[model samples]
Target: MISINNLTFEIGARALYDEANWHIKPGDKAGLIGANGAGKSTLLKLIVGDYAPTSGSISMAKDLKIGYLNQDLLSYHSDKSILHVAMEAFERQNQLHTEIEKLLLKLETDYSDDILNKLSDKQMEFEALDGYSIEFRAHEILAGLGFSEEEQKRPLATFSGGWRMRVMLARILLQTPDILLLDEPTNHLDLPSIKWLETYLQAFEGAIVIVSHDRYFLDRIINKTVESRKGKLTIYAGNYTFYLEEKSLREEIQSNQFKNQQAKIKQEERLIERFRSKASKAKMVQSRIKALDRMEKVDEVDDDNPEVNFSFKFSKPSGRHVVTMENISKSYPNLEILKNTDALIEKGDKIALIGANGKGKSTLLRIVADADNDYEGTSTKGHNVSQTFFAQHQLEALHLENSILQELVAFAPKHTETELRSILGCFLFTGDDVFKKIKVLSGGEKSRVALAKALTADANFLVLDEPTNHLDMASVNILIQALQQYEGTFIVVSHDRYFLENVANKIWYIEDKKIKEYPGTYQEYEAWSAKRVVKAEEPAVKKVKEEPKKVKAAPTEDNKRLLQKKNKELAALEEKIAQQEILVKDLEVELAKEEIYSDAVKLQDHTRRYNSEKASFDKLQADWENLAEEIMELEG
Candidate 1:
């Protein structure tokens, strides 16, 4: 548990936090959210004591352990295997293991009772700490984070930066500290790994503070939302969805109060001026002036979600079909990305390419973009097609010597300074910000510049790879809006489901070295994917043949009547069960709404209704199952 008391932290002239207070209690799951420059990551570092506050203090519960997973861990390397690296979290157990080994070696020589007793004590402690199974636990976590058993045996230095980050995440998880501080842990993960981490974090008993741009991850894992804005921390009682709703309501109320206070102040000011010359009202005017001076002014609400007003339209539209690939096969040593797979991308397609890391989503993207000619494939672009490819690596393509404005201006000579600046404004580079050199910009800022340049292309089809990387939620939303408004074909690879759901109309994934398409929105794809899993688990219904005639005569007729009655009952109960299911769902949704949460009585009432409906639905399901089994018995 940690408490931040009136924390005021500054960097030179700018205050990143001003009198911000937040209490991270045991078992609390909090999502730290804000725009790019709001110091979300800085707050995390301050909590971990990596940075000291300019004023005020941060206190933590004594002897509390903390496990932190951050991007900086990408630089960490060791000759030890990933499994060994992860198992290093068990410090006491590892020390005990070494001592036990020494004792066993000594026993082989001396065979003394003292050494035997020491060995016994060490073994007892090891077993108590579950030391022997630490390797298994480490392997399981590594695998969940997208490492193979064979890969886990490989040295940590052999992996890339992203993979190394996953290894660090595994180590932190193995540590199982009292509080876990994760900064964009989902950035390196694919969909499956993200889901695995979500499940693992949900079951984690310790407090968690996560600063992630992935709102989908925040919605699922964090129960509390903390918005870092204007040097202050605002807490939301629920997840991201609830925060959005509650924030809108709060802004509205604050806006009205601010308006009312302004009106009242104006009225009092007039009265003060009118009575200033009159001796009889001097005391009253003095009191009013003092009251007005001492009044705490309400700050106006800030619009965090800025609109992308700049229009982005390519000059040309491609033919109906965009990209076609046939007989595609890509192999790298022991791995095959695609094997004789065919893919078709038509015009007006907004595709979200997703899946695990090793699935070769990037390989397919390269093939589509004509960036890789080494793979075995027949790839063709549509007639009159013009395309632009955007990736994180493209950030380096920008002219560091040039300002943001100069970079775009040189890239698109056809567009005037006014037009270029307009686009830059949409990318959050307004006025003097456009004069900032590309070399001085943050990663997220440079990413925005690169994205803006990509949109300025005269191309009709766009290929984007993890475009949301290094971007805050606001910038991601801007990209989403720009893409949504653009009437062109594009395919983007991203693990941010919320962005994918909003910007993409089709979902594509790699399976068996083939590109697979799901012709629906991300939410629909999620539902269908889950339903497919459920369907796979369902038992196949066995067709019951006509009941074989039994030797019993009087009982047979009664059995037929009983079976018929039960069949009717089952049908009726099923119909009722279907309606009850809807009722329960409606009540559940109602209970989750912001309005219900704002009112205790409404929440309680809706919860009671939901529970009652759920209980009745369960009872109906039970009755149906029992009756169906009886009817089956009667049939036999």
Candidate 2:
């Protein structure tokens, strides 16, 4: 557990955090969110003591351990296997094991009692630390992060920067720190890896503070939200979605109060101005002035979400079919990506291709875009269809010397400078920002520039791969809006579910070396997949549950057949119970007759018959209740 109090941090003249306060309790899963450069990542660094706070203090439990995963860890290099790197989290255990090995060697040479005793003590400590199973634990965490067994055994220096980031993440997880501070933890993870991490974090006993733009990941993992805005930290009781709703409502109230306060001050000032010369109202004016001065000013809500006012248009509309693939098959050495897969893309179809890594999602996108032709397939475009491929490689395609505006101008020759700048504005590069050179921009800025260029192209069919990567929440929202308004067909491959759900009307996935389509939103696809998995495993689970019932004897047996029989008997007994009640009522009516009351014999006979019927009805009701209970239990 850690606590941040009155944290005021500054870089030269700029205050990154001003009087910010946030408390991370044990078992808390918190999402730290904000716009770009709002200091979410900086706050994480402050927590881990990478930078000293300008003022205030951070308090933590003395024995509390913190594991931080950040982009800077990408520079870490090592020749040791990834497994060894991950298992390094057990530092004490590793040292103990080394000592034990040395003692064993010394005993082999000297056969001394001191060496044997030292080895025994070291072995006891190692066993207590569970050093023997550390490798297994490290392997499990690495695999969950999408590392294969062989890859885990390979040297860490052989992996790319993104894969190295995953290794750092794995090491942090293996450490089992008391609190985890993760900055964009899902950035390097694919969809399946993201899901696996979600499950792992859900079960993690330690607290977590995640700074990420992945809304879906935040919603699935975090129970609380801490929004960094205007150099202050504000806490919400629930996840990202809840924070949005609660913030909207709070802003509405604040805006109203601010308006009302302004009106009151205006009225007071007018009275003061008109009554300055009048002696009678002087005291009232002064009182009103003091009240206005004492009142706390309410701040107006900032407009965080900006609409993408620009529209995407192409010169020619595509035919009914935008793209078609027949008998498509792609493979690599020792890996089969796609096998005779057939898929078609119709005009106006916004398909989201999703799945785990190594499933050929990007490969399939390349094939559709005609960027890769080595595969055996027939890929074609419809008449009048113009294609544009937007990928991470697009970042590489941008000229570093060119400004954002110049880049757009080169891509879209027909659009005027004013028109191109308008599109750039929607991507958050406004005014002078459009003139900034591509070389000066950050990774996220470059991505936005690439996306702006992609939109500038007059293409009727768009193939976007990981379009939301390196984008902030606001940038992702802008892209979603742009895609929503675009009339052309597009297929986007992204791991962000919120982005996919908002933009796509169809879902595509690869399974069993074939392409599959689900004609619904990402939310619908998730629900269907969940039920499908349950149904797939239900047969085996149901068989295990039914085996005992099938072999039981008649008394204990409550199989389907016996359950049905009980249900039938309960139904029949209810009818008899109903008739018995009517019979008892009829007997009561006869006993109440005037003639029967006057004659002793008739009255006695009628009373006795009524009593007999009532007793019979009571017994019948009791039997029905007992049978119903038995049936209920048997069914339960």
| Best candidate according to lDDT | 1
Q: Give the TM-score of candidate 2.
A: 0.82
Give TM per candidate: 0.84, 0.82
- Model 2 lDDT per residue over 415-454, tens place: 9998998898898988799889999998999999998888
* Deviation of model 2 at 298, angstroms: 1.4
In candidate 1, the residue pairs with backbone N, CA or C atoms under 3 Å apart (3 or more residues apart, or in different chains) clash, namely: none
- Give one digit per residue, the lDDT tens place, for model 1 in 211-274: 9999989887787899999999999989999899999999999999999999999999999999
lDDT score at residue 335, model 2, on the 0-100 scale: 96
Error of 1 at 619 (Å): 26
On TM-score, the leading prediction is 1
RMSD in Å for model 2: 16.0
lDDT of 1 at 95: 99
The per-prediction CA RMSD against the true structure, in angstroms, equals 7.5, 16.0
